[model samples]
Target chain A: MSTDALTLDRLARMQTAVVLGYDPKFPAARRERFEDLGLLPDTTVQRLHTAPLGDPIAFSIRETVLCLRREDARRIFVKSVLP
Target chain B: MSAASLIAEEEKLATVALVGSPNCGKTTLFNAMTGMNQKVGNYPGVTVEEKDGLLVRGGRKARILDLPGLYGFSAMSPDEAIAREIIEGKSAFERRPDAVLFILDGSALHRSLGLLATVLQEGLPTAVALTMVDEITARGGRLDTLKLSRALGVPVFGVVGHKGTGVAEVLDAAVDAQSWPRPVVAAPLESAVARAAWSDTVLQECYREPKKENRLSRRIDEFVLHPVMGPVIFLLVMGFLFQAIFTWAGPLMDLMSGACSGFGAWIESWAPAGLPRDLVVHGVVEGVGGVLVFLPQIMILFFLINLLEAVGYMARAAFLADRLMGFVGLQGRSFVALLSCHACAVPGIMATRSIPSESDRLKTMLVAPFMVCSARLPVYTLLIAAFVPERAFWGPLGIQGLILFGLYLFGAVTAFTASWVLSKTLVKGSLLPFYMELPPYRWPTFRNVFLSMWHRAKIFVSRAGRVILPASMLLWVLLAFPRAQADPGVPAAVAQSRQLQQSFAGRIGRFVEPVFAPAGFDWRINIGVIASLAAREVVISTLAQIYGVESEDETGLVDMLKKARDPETGRPLMDFPTAMALIAFFVFALQCISTLAIMRRETETWKWPAFAFGYMGVMAWIAAVAAYQILSRLSV
Candidate 1:
């Protein structure tokens, strides 16, 4: 598969940087709050687990389990060990 | 693990404590279980409060305690301390729950599961209530509910608490399920290496991520959190909320005022002539009516706040304000509590319970009185009507409402500065770091919205009955007594009323007039100030009583206020500048008894409230004096 087409599960295990900022899908309010809570781009986060329905994805950053809408997750770039 | 030893001793009707991170729909589930059966109050020593309720789930009725939301249960913060104590049955929180409803957002299972995993090792009989199922589904994620349930060795139920979807089913299953056969409890991690080793394995078995485009939230957060535009958006949103409140509540305010005045007039005809009629019309009706008029304003504010909180915008506001608020040595959460003081300070001070830090809580309670409360409305209205020209600024901004808004802004600024000064001078401390969980945005339930509004209205009316009525009656006695003796040289009407000028109130104000001379306040204004200490709304009623008006609700208050003549110049009493001075005085003054009472109770110290009143009183007088001097000089 192309690098851009990498599976989310693979992306979860890898750590990379995403160029863009807040995702477009969820409300602006949530993203702003996440940023205030120090969950911003280029910050290293371990992608933990997604719920069965998978809207709010959990990531472990600075030992805090920060939950973000999936749309927010895609905007976030994670470097991959496999890549 | 002896889990069986711990469980076989569990009592039926055992308490179930629902604990989780904030914004996890925990409150919604609590409400679903308990209905109108929750009590809100402060916890011991610390202000971050507790909410308690009883739930009848399954075949047995168990006490359900809703603990303050914690990011984790590691016993670090006061909130976490309470959660841990309850779980360990070490705290006086009515003993440990028989089981725990370890509720988490189904949308963020892994992060939530991190906490859940900790709870599982606690060896407590626990079940998971997976909420926000629909929101998760919409995001193209799915949960293996049965598989996860089996792996965790506990029952898990899917619930949408707001919609009442699958709530009863989940609740029934949760309360009915007994302790499972005792299983091995994980050993406590010995070191950093051990913890790292354990958490990795826990994540592997139960967690998954969805494969999709994370495009939506990213785009929105970009514009909203933009350094330049974010604060602007916040202000515009707040401005719109205020404008909507004023426009929406205007008609209701007018209707209520009219009905009150009509009722007062009708009662006047039935009351005996002289003191009885004056007391009924001027003291009771006008005093009470003044407070009632602000009902719509209070209601509108409450509704808007509840809506904001429900829709989850409140958390976002806190996020935006966090940095600015830290400068004043307060958590961003304290802003909402202090803002609510504009409606009434009592509840505002009570709301300080939500601020986890004791120093932040005390400081918030102390400065809350400085916020111009709804009680100050009557004073502002009377003065504005008497003197302010109704001309609009730039043809759109109401000069009157703008003035009112300016006073509100002044109060807010003063409150922040005062807190900063207090933190530096007396309550010395570095600002505490804040951690808050921002919940997902959701539609507000109409039930919660209406219920909150109703609660506020009830508090308003009850206060009117308990405090306002007695205070107005006392003012009535002071105004009405000491019947004039006949003087041969004077006409009967003149002779009968001369005693009022000689009576205690008259003598008192005259004695104090020199003190307020610099502030441009005459004896009448001084007397009005004295009467307002009982309740600020009583000032207008007292003024109407002193003016010898029998019916003061509508015609009496307005006419007498217009007729008031300045003792210094013998001109119309309330000139534009003097009216401006009066508004400024009330804007800064700590006049409300209710506010002081709440402050004293919250702080558990009479010294704080007394000191607050002294400082604000001095500030008010100086500000008013300076304003008057400037206006008088410019006029000359």
Candidate 2:
């Protein structure tokens, strides 16, 4: 499975994952914060929105935005949120 | 009428807090808004203090909160934790600030905006206080404040905080918005996940492409931050500042000394003979003047340093020296406190709070006493004048100032080595990563510069009165008492001192003499050093008293220091070997009483302070012995 193929949907259910990498192709203003947000390896994040510019993929963890780039989204591992 | 009444009833008092990194002109804005109508009080539950001021805008008073300078609201430091707990409204401290005024340094908005974005997401009635807007434009960069203001969906005010420009309008907008309920956080997320929408929207709206590079800043940084050139610049700058201490103070010091001694002599004649005359002329005037002579040098050194700090170059200097400091097992931030030691060490120890780590602060506090403070200026100046020839040793270098600078350098190096050894043995921790934002340079305002210098000079003089005065008087009493019968055929004056030399203090000096002999310190120097435990300036006065000279004798300090005779060998006491040894000893000795007081305050346990003093005492002895032996062998 291509890392880019792992969508936020794929990420939300992951029991454990690290932000192994990131892609700047997305037009995120705070790429560094997104990278250095100190997210634990293999945490769950539920995707909420995809902005009009096809970047700034917003998600929720403890009700905080765990925004990530498309490539960053791929690096994270997850189990499906679906039962 | 119904809309107005409903809106009025719904409004609640709220807070707009300003938080940013230090030196970002936040205080200036706070001052302009609050003036003297501010209060500094600790947070209700935490020891960390908070400053709150009331600002009137749109005919309503809004509480302006100035939190501690936090680099980010997240992270584990107490400062950060406090900010986090407050924002979350989970802490025992007052509820979450009603709103936050995210002040960003316009010149460095990229990083500043990162913090701004975090604050904006709190779902509070927020605004952006864009500071240093003029500096950005002046430096060939332009900002569309309106663009930023619109994008963030909140009021954004372009303010030059220091000059009070555009701040009034900013306050008016803020105060007006305070009563209005927070606008629906319109920037969209999935309706189900609206909670995270605010964070994403704020980050997107408030920031733009940073100017590719700060060209002039980069050029200067290259040389100033170069490892090789950096330390050289630091040394040269410190050398210049220390040199100015003596060279600049010469005329003023002379004027002060002359006025004091002349007044002393004049008073002696006018006063009727009795206890009154002795107490007034000898105890009060002479002792006070002795301490006052060093004030000029202390003020001058402090003035230069305060200016450097205000102009923001000191932080850069610290950044440059971080590597070298790490080599010696200290963080670069400790350099600010150590640099302050040149003026006095008490406040320097207090300044170590910026170090953030307990062990690092402790290490800084332990070594700070070794930094030759202004109290030692009199002793160094008197000795150098006595021993070193006035002729320039290195063409342009003033021999006296060079020696003074050397003494300061010896303390600094020894402090570094001491901290390094402690780290290896007791303070076992790997060096933490040091991160500091370099504040953009600014021309320091004259009022601020002078006020800071005045503050430091006031501290030095007050310490003299509270500590030095009684300490000198006690020694004076010890030497003056126990009048022995005059030896037959000897003048009563000469015989009195001879008899007094066997007094308790004198005997104690003799008893301690053998311990100091390896360092070539004579009995008088031994007494001077012991008396100096109260404060170093007393060493000069104590020596004067021992030499049977009045404290106001301007010439005796120089002459006696030169003429001091070694008891065993009957040679000049402060010759090359002894001079070097004395300098080295003062360099390593933690002799200042205030240092002891501060150490006790900083470390609740007296045991650690006792250990600190014991460690420095042993180090001082070893250093003095080594210096004396090395110089003596060279002479032979």
Candidate 3:
């Protein structure tokens, strides 16, 4: 409910964001995978592009571009950082 | 099952593993390390395959295993699970690897290095084969391999896996498993948070990424991933892929078919002319050769698909198809598989290995056969040529062409529908997160491509020779026996017909005729259906035989088919409804034995194949009856 509680899915294309931790309601197993993938707090992720059909957004996280579905991406909260 | 023969008895060769995240060039490294000296087999109790190769240096041999790609230590998929258990020495299925040669992709260092935390935690003697360092340098990135080695407490050697650069040093160090040093400090296992922090610390010390991300992939993606242009390009690429399979593989397939038949005839010339010769020539050789002819198309398909995969286009293709495939309850990769089925389902089914999810792969496997393959071409051509009128519907599209296109469309729609129904009924909801790594574009090395093509062709040929040959022989027996009791003076064609009508296969055909009666199939058509199991084209020859026409004389056969009548009804043997029904059935039926054989091998079980056969048989019957009824009613 805080003003800074923006999720990864809302981040603009090519805009970098600082990880603000995963949503508490996110399933534990999947959330754990996000952590393993270097989504730790303060890690910077940049939204690169959306797939042709507008999902599985490609994001540069920890120097690798991962194509993630919007459903999972939306569950990870982040604060958009200006270029 | 292993490279055991390369070592002496009672002397166990040291084992080394090439481990990395997917698309990190681990397989490239495997080939670089052990070229033309590898074996591939399924890991016990899993459909995932195991590949290990022999490495010998100065009289010392080490077996190198190429573990499946993984992202992190916490196993998310079956591939990761298999790799995880083997590394931790917990696998009852495989001996613990003596050392781990971590394949580090310099271009994706942060995550790739972070994955190293898990590998380091294993505490197995470790060395890193730093790959794609040139990619980093080309992009103006700097990497000090010596500093990286010192930071990680393991030897690090930069290597271009495709070019076989620096492979000798890595293999030299890895070959002596006991001498390789373990990590100075085992990584924290409590959480990825701790590991990520530690890995970042290591990166901070020695890694400098290209300030600018690789721009080539970005520039290409701008057009390839454009909403309109991207899809158009995807279609053009897919259209080209299918066209290659259908048109290009034709001459090669014809050549193979010619060789098989010529060899069969040559052998027949040497052997005595009798029932045995007939069985050997017509039953075993022709039956087996029919399936062998598919090798050209299958191998060509395998090569192109692997090329797309290795060059990273397949990931882009997968991304483009995600939403569409998701609509049909499949991963984006399933689109390629289903499309490949349009050429042949065997390779289509084989291509499902790229689908990360197990159930999605199985569902895709189940759905693949419904797509019209080249095998069905002969039957469709025969039916259309024999019954369907040849009037032009439009430019470049005749009634015959429209009918063929309609059959293709029907197959495609049915494939998607079958997948949807399966999603709801059998596989249920796909709960796995639909995530994939859209890797940066890279040119495929000819070494990797050729090895891939050769490996697949070998597997297909050997497996086909083993499984399909015997099954075809059984079908031959059904069409070849019971001694028709015709005098030797009779004509060959009449003798052949009588012989076929009394053969066990014919008896079964007659027995099964009533079951298909409602679908407008007679005993002769039933015989064609039963014989088509060898391959869909076999129906043409089978039908040609029973109709008392020469096997190769298709024109004569079509004429006879059109003029022939049912003795009971005094009507044409194949009316419009009957032809329509047969075409409908062929579109839906799982008639090819090779498809089922590969399904059995890929799934590692007969249960799924049996299920496929049962469901497709039922659907084919229903579709046939519906087609027959609709057309007959309209005509009347």
DockQ of 1: 0.05
* Model 3, C-alpha of B511: deviation from truth (Å): 1.4
Query: Interface Cα RMSD for all candidates?
Result: 13.1, 15.4, 1.7
Q: Best-fitting candidate, measured by lDDT?
A: 3
Candidate maximizing TM-score: 3
Tens-digit per-residue lDDT, B233-314, candidate 1: 7677677665655566668878988998999889886877776687778788876875676577667777777787887666
Model 1 CA lDDT for position B102: 81
Clashes of each: 28, 5, 0
Winner by TM-score between candidate 3 and candidate 1: 3
Looking at model 1, residue B264 earns an lDDT score of: 89
CAPRI-style grade of the A/B interface in model 1: incorrect
Model 3 regions more than 4 Å off: A2-4, B5-10, B186-189, B391-398, B429-431, B551-553, B567-571
User: What TM-score does prediction 3 earn?
Assistant: 0.96
Candidate 3 at residue B597, lDDT?
87
Q: Per-residue lDDT of B1-636 in model 2, one digit per residue for the tens?
A: 122122333655456677675566777777677665565534543335566667776578666777776555533455556766776677675557777777777765544554555555567777778888777766566667777777676677889866778988877765664653343444433321232334335445544434443455546645764547756887787677656764677788788979988898999988897567867776778678766766786577667767877776676665555655767778666886787677677667755655655677788888888888877877777777876778887878987888788887878887888899988888765222233445556777655566545645554566334555665566656655555554678655456446457666677788999899999987877877877876787777776666655446658667877776645578775787787788778777888666665555455456766888899889889989998999889943
True contacts kept of 1: 0.00
Report chain B TM per candidate: 0.78, 0.70, 0.96
- The digit string of per-residue lDDT tens for model 1 on A1-83 reads 23474322335422433323443553554444344343544444555433323334445453244545444455444444333
